[model samples]
Target: MIDLQTKLVGLIGKPLEHSLSPWMHNETYTRLGLNMAYLPIEVLENDLETVINGIRKMNFIGFNVTIPHKISIIPYLDDIDPLAKQIGSVNTITCCNGFLKGYNTDGEGFVSYLETSQGINCSDKVFLIMGSGGASRAIAMTLAARKAKKIYLFNRTIEKAKQLASEIMSYYDCICQAKNLDDTTLKALIKKADVLINTTSVGLYPNIDQTPVKYDLLSSHLIVADIIYNPLHTRLLQEAKEKGCGIVTGEGMFVNQGAKAFAIWTKQPAPYSMMKRVLEEKLI
Candidate 1:
């Protein structure tokens, strides 16, 4: 049990009913005997400013930003972390000296998980990213910073994908290109990709049938990753596994990112083992 006077923290996003952040953070806080509570604040687009301003006046210590608010919350922040600025998104926010500072723990979380769990150094790998949204930007920027040999982005909208590629190229020396996910182009790209990542909402809940790439295009040499953890193993990951490709689930990303946010909020090393145990228990 934690001290009753512990601080409050939480996640802010629309439709946060499915979030596991509260469970993970509160469990850690209890395990450490810290006085903190994590909650979920579901806010729509119009309520964004109101919610942020309210956080300032509340007893909240910090909050994790998610989904639609990741990029939209940037303008409301007092300051942004350089990495978050570069990635053009913020997933972690902390109150420091009466100011809210935004940070992008997603990139660091992805890189850390890759190194620690998969032993896969992204530096020399060719990355084919699917999506042009906030998650894709963070993942693409991290891959470029890690010295990925080449990074290709495929999105339904060619212009959006190109825009993301342009932004990433400004800071890192990498061959970044964008492609439209036509049947022909997608098949060709998947055949050549060493690491294929789905950063889009494809294969997520309510749209589990939709996958960014065709399964027939995948090969054993590919390392397939989908950032959809709700179903544990997305159809994309399951199909890739059937093809003998290495698979990485979104749970790894969720745990790592949450751990980073927990560390930032408490200024203490995250209780990763305890956190993971809590997550597993909730999942079961």
Candidate 2:
């Protein structure tokens, strides 16, 4: 029953072909009897500003940001949440009275997934995060804020990882280190890590065969997590399982994040169970 009164929400990013956000959000809306709809809008980097300007003039409640646009979209928004500003990325945006605000739900969402679903506490754990992108920044900052004992950031570009680590060290009382993606460093750091998270798009859909870390680096004591939910079982998770490592799929973070974003937009508790079921069904 979509009409002029329906509140529209969207996911804005490129290569949204594999996104499960629309299904998850719309199912929750249907179950809750909300007059809302979620759509996926594929927009390239060059057209982000133009698309955002168009959204402002429409009846949109809010939208989710992803991938290449997360960091770049900051300037276009009217305001930014403190956490998102600090993390240097924006994954969620809200619109009210024609004013758009940005937020980074990725970190909080991932932490919620780890704490609630996996029973992992950040206070005493050592984390090895791969990548320095939007998702990576959010997760690292969140973990640091949670009093994680140590965080090691690894990325293709050492400087980016170093910058993130420096920020975490300056703001939080945590041991943060940054390193270039090398076999020697990975071998050493992974031995000391309790959790290894992949925030990179290496194992995303269409390139499902690629992985960020070598299979041999995984161990029984490590909990490997990936943020790429499209494939459900990425090659990194697959190999981690084979090596007797505990694997946390991207679905938990995806659902938890969507739940948070839903609450932000609707000003009500999200239907987590329904959203999780819908996302799991789509992935299956």
Candidate 3:
């Protein structure tokens, strides 16, 4: 049912061949009877300028950004949401009359998922986040915005973790500090934190057995979350649940993020259930 009249939206990043966004977004459009096509346009770092220029010339509604472009896309955008500005990254973009507006929905998506899927609230909760990459940045920024009481951030590289913690401390009133993953102090903090989030790719496909922390170290009092959805249930999550800890999978964040993007582009309610099903089907 697609034609020249179909509105165009897509993703821009190198190595986009591995992205499942097109499948999830296209299925949503088709299921909703909307004439829109979401494509995965791989644009290398050197070609970002050209691709952005082309987006302005075309009839594109909006698109998503990934990897290297998230922060780099800032100057090119006509406007930016405050959340995106604070996170120092942009993932969703809206085009209006050739004007591009940048947004970072990753944090919103993650927060919304925790709230609706697990009855978790950011305020007054202590978070123990593993990793200091883009995913962790978004989640940490969002939690800070939501007024989380404290966050004990951990990373293999202490400097990277400290940098992120410094940013949070500079901007928010929350008690955020960096700690070493192998440190006895961080391990003690984890046992008492309200939530434990694994934002690293250690538990991803091929490394299915790898986890940020040992399973026996997990506490039943903590709500564990891993932001790797490929296997649906990572080893950390399996171990957490087995020890009677509540767990949140990466699937909720993945689906909710796209749902936010869909809402942004269409200005309508996304079929949340179907979007979840589409990705679940792909994983299976």
Best by lDDT: 2
TM-score against truth, every candidate: 0.95, 0.95, 0.97
Q: Report lDDT per candidate.
A: 0.86, 0.91, 0.90
lDDT tens readout by residue for model 3, 1-284: 77889999999998887789999999888888899999899988889989999999898999999987998889999999988888889999999889999988898898889877778778978999999988899999999988998998899998988999999888899889899878577668976799999999988988898888886688899899988887789999999999899999998999999999999998999898999999988988
lDDT (Cα, tens digit) per residue for candidate 1, span 119-161: 7888778889989888888889988888888999998888989
Q: How many residue pairs clash in each candidate?
A: 1, 0, 0
Report the Cα lDDT for residue 284, model 1. 66
Best by TM-score: 3
User: In model 2, which regions exceed 4 Å deviation?
Assistant: none
Report the candidate with higher TM-score, 2 versus 3. Answer: 3
Q: Sort by lDDT, best first: what order?
A: 2, 3, 1
Clashing pairs in 2: none
